[model samples]
Target: MEYLILAIIGLASGIVGALVGLGGGVILVPATLFIGINLGMIDGITPQTVVGLSVVMMIFIGLASTLSYMKSKTIDYRSSLIFFAGSIPGTLLGAYVNKGLDLPSFNLYFGILLIILSTLLLVRKYLKPVEWFVKHGKKRSFTDATGETFVFGYPVWFALVLTFGVGFASGLFGIGGGSIIVPAMILLFLFPPHVAVGTSMFMVLLSAVVNSITHISLGNVPWLYTIPVIPAAYMGAKIGAALNQKMKSETLVFALRIILLLLGVRSIIDGIWG
Candidate 1:
């Protein structure tokens, strides 16, 4: 019965994750806690265990999502490769560091990071308009506007540095790395929103895979929970990628931001009350 409940939560999370670039962390973590409580796993250390399990599950989710995007030709493989170059090592290091940290500290830091991510999502729309004006300057057909053109707008070295930081946080917090990578890609690398989402998903695939290994090494993941969620997440990703191509840019961004804010708030409240 508990597994059934978790599977349902996974199904809902998978759908939301597909629509947004989040790897279902916002849904998975809280759901895990709820299930853990019901299953008598709600010891003081349950949150950390939940995070570990979620990160492990995100590996499969990211891979499944990336495959769907890849089939649609939405993935920017070159950029993903560049991001992964830095992220792989960072994930390992983060996993090692996390293995030594206490659960309460991890929860506190995770909560703080979610709050920061929520603020970033909330402000992205306003910032984008300003950035669009600054970059395009009333010309929509500028080099940046050409959908066919791809450029590494940021210094490659700087982007690599940022990728490492983002990946480390992802590993530590059980996130998709999209929350950090998408904004960086848009603001720093000048990727279009859709491309940023696609590229970030690909990058997340690599980061999650690397991070999952670390979690496994630590014996922190719950396979019983993960096995049933993978296929549902994959299906969600397929539907999401298709929907993404049809949505207007402004509408998608607006919706994503609102969702992020609500999820973040819910997560914070759950953390406080749980």
Candidate 2:
């Protein structure tokens, strides 16, 4: 019965995650923690353990989203590779750091960061955007699987630094790196929203895989908790991917921004009172 409940939770999370390029952390982390506490089966589940299980569910969810994004020819592999160069190492380091963190402190800090990021995203949309740095990078173009080419000029060096920071937070929180990556890609690197979403999913896949290994080394994950949710997460990812293509980019970003704000507040409140 516990496993059945986990599956249902995972299913809902997977769909929302894939849709917003969040890899399900916003829905999964809080839901799992609160519900697990309510149920005796997960009576003593630590934040690290909750994060580890979230990683398991996200891996499959990211994979499903990746495949769907690939079919639609929106993934920007070149950018992904550059970001991964930094993200991989960062995730490894973050996982180790996360093992020692207290839940309340982590929640407080992470929530603050999320809220800040969400504010920045919101501010950039309606206000005059300030140029962070001057980049004279050369424009580049790449063709995707469906013979569609995307051309853009981006600050590669800046992206690397940012990706590492995002990866660290992702590993620490088991968010699969998409929460930061998607917004960064769109708001920072100037990628089209759809491309950002697609490429972010791929980055999430890599970050989650690396992060999961670190969690495993610390014994944060239990196979039984992970197994039941895998299939449900996968199914949800497929549906999310389909929805992503149909939704307008502006609409998608707007929804994600709102979700992030809510997640941030929830974490802060939980940290303070729960």
Candidate 3:
């Protein structure tokens, strides 16, 4: 039964993560904590354990989504490498920071993070792209499947700084960092939405590898739970990537925002009460 629940969590997280380029850790981490600690359905759970598991699961989710995006030719390889340069070290620092957080503190912080992410998603469509970053930075062009050409770029220095912060949050919170990265790419860098999502997954894959290794070394991962989660998430990622190409996601985004908001509130309440 526990394995089944884990699998469902992985599947749902993978689909949402790949579709939105958030790497699914937001879903995985919160769900795991709710089931194991809040609800008392599973044993030996902790903030550290759930975080480690989420990062480990992201390895598979990132790989699957990145591969799917590769076929679509939406991934910006050059940008991905640049983002990695900063994110790698940021993740290392974040993993160390995670060790210091107890459950109540983790819940409070994580809840705040979720609310922030939810607000970002809510405001994203209404925000205009910042032209300063695009005009001042190096430029690149992409022609999509529909033969529409789009150009986008960002200052290298600024990108490094942004991704470093994103990585730190990922390592500290066990999120994929896409919640912040995707919006930055689209609004600040003028990236096409598809390209941003694809490239973000590539970055997620790279950062997850580093973060998961760091968590494993700290003995935070619960291997048993991962057994059921990994494969499910991988398959779900494929489906999500396909869905991204085929449909409008406005309604889905709205639903996701509501879910995040509720989760954030509950987490905050639990943190305060406990």
TM-score of each: 0.82, 0.91, 0.93
Query: Which residue pairs clash in candidate 1?
Result: none
Please report how far candidate 3 places residue 238 from its true position, in Å. 1.2
What's the true lDDT of residue 76 in model 1?
A: 73
In candidate 2, which residue pairs clash? none
- The TM-score between candidate 1 and the true structure equals 0.82
* Candidate 1 structure quality by residue, lDDT tens digits, 48-160: 56667667667666776777777656677777888889888777777777666554455456656766766775676566433432343212211223355544444556667
Query: Model 3 compared with the native: what TM-score?
Result: 0.93
Give residue 142's lDDT in candidate 1 (0 to 100).
Answer: 14
State candidate 2's TM-score: 0.91
Error of 3 at 245 (Å): 1.3
Tens digit per residue, CA lDDT, model 2, 113-164: 7798788788867754324422445466656434666555566777778888
Per-prediction CA RMSD (Å): 4.4, 2.8, 1.9
Q: What are the per-residue Cα lDDT tens digits for candidate 3 across 1-274?
A: 8899999999999998998788998888878888988888878889999999999999999999999999988899999989988888889999999999999998888889778878877897787767899899999998877788888989999999999999999999898787678867876897877888899999999999999999999999999999999999999999988887775445546655676787788778768885
Pitting candidate 1 against candidate 3, the one with the higher lDDT is 3
Error of 2 at 13 (Å): 1.9
